[model samples]
Target chain A: MSALITCSHVDFGYENHDAVVDLSMEVEEGDYFCVVGVNGSGKSTLVKGLLGLLKPTAGTITVAEELKRTGIGYLPQQTRSQRDFPATVCEVVLSGALSRRGSRPFYSSAEKRMATSAMEKLGIQSLQNHCYRELSGGQQQRVLIARALCAARKMLILDEPITGLDPWAIQDFYGLIRHLNREEGVAIFMVTHDVANVVSQADKILHLQQKALFYGTPSEYEKSPQGRKFLGGGDLWE
Target chain B: MGVIMEMLSYPFLVRAFVGGILISICAALLGVSLVLKRYSMIGDGLSHVSFGALSVAVAAGWAPLFVSMPVVVLAAFFLLRITENGKVKSDAAIAMISASALATGIVATSLTTGMTTDVSSYMFGSILAMSPRDVKLSAMLSAVVLGLFVFCYNKIFAVTFDESFARAAGVNVSFYNILIAVLTAVTIVLGMRMMGAMLISSLIIFPTLTSMRVFKSFRGVVLSSGIVAAVCFCIGMTASYRFSTPAGASVVLVNLAAFSGFWAAEKGIQRKNKGERRL
Candidate 1:
């Protein structure tokens, strides 16, 4: 598969210190690349760099031209404040398309159609007018996923999306994301702690703790010494 | 009825209504974004800054509008900056600026000596204080706020909901955040003549919060906030005129009443939903 994302020796950080140092990885087309790491491992920061939210102090991140503008829909880590934000699902989902809507202050008909389609795709059409905060965790995640989808058709970057979900919801969410990756053929770059499900479905795995510990196909990762140590002897107990 | 008509015919009352409505609309415009971003306290802090500048202007025999406007706007921007980048947290920054400005205002007022009535009037906001020139200035600033807000509605919505996501989507989050702060500063300054430094922030807070009891969409909140603000101000102005009550306090009370009613009604609805689900 061809590479859609090419990060060459990237170093990213905040003002005082670097969180990610000399990390290089590639997200191949239709790749379910799961980034597994411990807390404070710079996984979210790396996602920020790739999304162009944080500028790399050194090295390069090249996204394909077609997927550059509104091409990589991002579902950022849902925080406590955002969970209670006073906005409807429609408004929240519609905002994902703002980057591509250009100078128009009002949402265009086509953009509205895109939002509707995204909501339908996630089976959240009925919840369009509902307050986002009032929804269940699973439902809220679906709305967020629809929002990300509205922005980009080619790829999704989900950052710790299942942080607040219950077991049943997590399973449902995993099924949906896997379905999106396999059936819709959308490349997914996920930063997750769910080692079992992500590793099992992932085409590639990049184990990180400030730097790359392992980078290979899931099967290859299963045999690696570092992966065995990290993944508890490569047993997918969950 | 004849007395009410006579009051309406007075030019100062007309000016009050004109300027009050304009300021109310503009405040509502900034209200949703401000309250949502958890920067509602910034409005109160900036209003205190305006009071300090106003007292300085009064003591120095300067134009209050000219003296207070730039200072308050600068304070607003500074507050935004320090809150975002500096070591001090936003609430603490607001508290420091608020206390310091209030202290400065009280000291300046004490030095002025003879203008206690004017200073007191500013503190409580006399409806008669809104001159024709004040009306014109507020009208012009209101247009600018309305124009910019309408032109950048989508971008502002994105920034309000998620700054990181907005930044990732290439929305210039910093610029928009600063823009919201600046507009809020302008609203606080303009509304202070009718709403007072002590009470003007209610205009910046009440409408959006009251609307949130019912509407979930950002657009819904904006529209409803404007309507609620305009209606409450009208009622407050009319009641204050008829009863000779303090206009600023009257308007704030009106807003408080609306919020109380909405809150109760929301509880009722939730209770009803629970009942239905139980059945």
Candidate 2:
């Protein structure tokens, strides 16, 4: 399948410190690709490079479409900033719609309807007016997901979307990601530390160890050496 | 009461009172967002920068308005860009520039001789020194800040809460952040004549902190902060006039009183609620 996002021999760093080195990967259209890695594994760096938030220190990166300005929804790691920020859910969701169409004087009715529909799709209609900070961790994730849904152009890029959530919340979050992928066909590129929890839902798995170690279906990842190590040396429990 | 009546009768006194009211309202409104986003130091830094600029203008015999406002606004722009680019931590940039600005103002003012006629008034604030020009400028700034806050309140809230979320959703977080910074610059510029550099940050921080203790929602915080600030300005101005004290100190003292009152009342209510539940 043709790729929606492609990174060719990319090198990225921050403040003269290299985070990722000579990495290459591809994200196809309609792919729910979960990027799994240990802490400081440059998972977030890869996502940032892909989103053009951080330009690669070396090599060429290209996407199928003009991705720079087009709607690429992002869920950052620190959700507290969004939580304590003084904005209602509807206003936040409408921002997603705005990102898709930047600098527009106003949002059209259709865009408003789409944002509302996205919120409803995420089953957060009642949260439309709630202050984001007041919500539980699970509810906040759903709201952020809804916001991403409003703005994402055929794909969403989330950085550890399941952190600080309980098991039920994580399950529900996974369910929501799956629902977005299966029912709506929105591609997902999420960097996750909870490899096992999200493994079942991830359509394609991209395992990173400072480089693209494995990029294929979950079953294929299981056969790879790193994946075997990840799964506790083929015994399945570590 | 008689002294207050007499002070209220004077037009300049009334003007200063009104000016303080307007300034307090705007500062408090901006403070809500600033404190939430941890940009309280921005207010402090800009106030110092403006103080320096005003001192320069005074020493150079130029209109303080033209010199101070632009300098602080430019500083605000640079501060926002630096912080947003993640080149320097926001607070660090603020401390560096603000300290330098304060030092520059002190040195410049000290270098200029023969203008010791109530310079301390400007240093500590002399609301009574506010001319018609100052009142008009304060009113204009208050109106602009209030108008922009209304029109872009939603967007500003979005950006302040989560710039990434706002950017992801399609909000131009950079522009909004700059807008907030500019507004803060304006607020500090106008506030310098009344609140002074050393005490102005409290005008931005205390009202918000007090309101946060009592309010549960965004709207509640904004409205309550505005009200509390207005009252503080009024009482502070009156107290300064009656007691022949520094207007800036009076205003801040008034704010502290209001804050303490709110805190005590909130605690009292919570204790009563607990006792009722126990019963």
**Number of the top candidate by TM-score?**
1
Pull out the clashing pairs in model 1: none
**After superposition, candidate 1 runs with Cα above 4 Å error:** A222-225, A232-238, B1-3, B86-88, B275-279
Q: Of the candidates shown, which would achieve the greatest lDDT relative to the real structure?
A: 1
Residue B217's C-alpha lDDT in candidate 1? 81
TM per prediction = 0.94, 0.82
- Write down the RMSD of all candidates, one decimal each: 2.7, 4.3
TM-score of chain A considered alone, across all candidate predictions: 0.93, 0.90
- Candidate 1 chain A: minimum summed lDDT over ten consecutive residues — where? A229-238
Question: Global lDDT for candidate 2?
Answer: 0.79
Candidate 1: lDDT over CA atoms? 0.87
Model 1 per-residue lDDT tens digits across residues B128-236:
8788887888889888877877898889888888887788778888888888898889888878867888999999999999999977788888889999999999889
Write one digit per residue (lDDT tens) for candidate 1, span A1-238. Answer: 7788899999998989889999989997888989998999999999888887788999999887767744789999886667778889999999989878777778889999999999998999999999998999999999989989999988999999899899999999999999899988889999998887777889889988888988888888778876776778755553
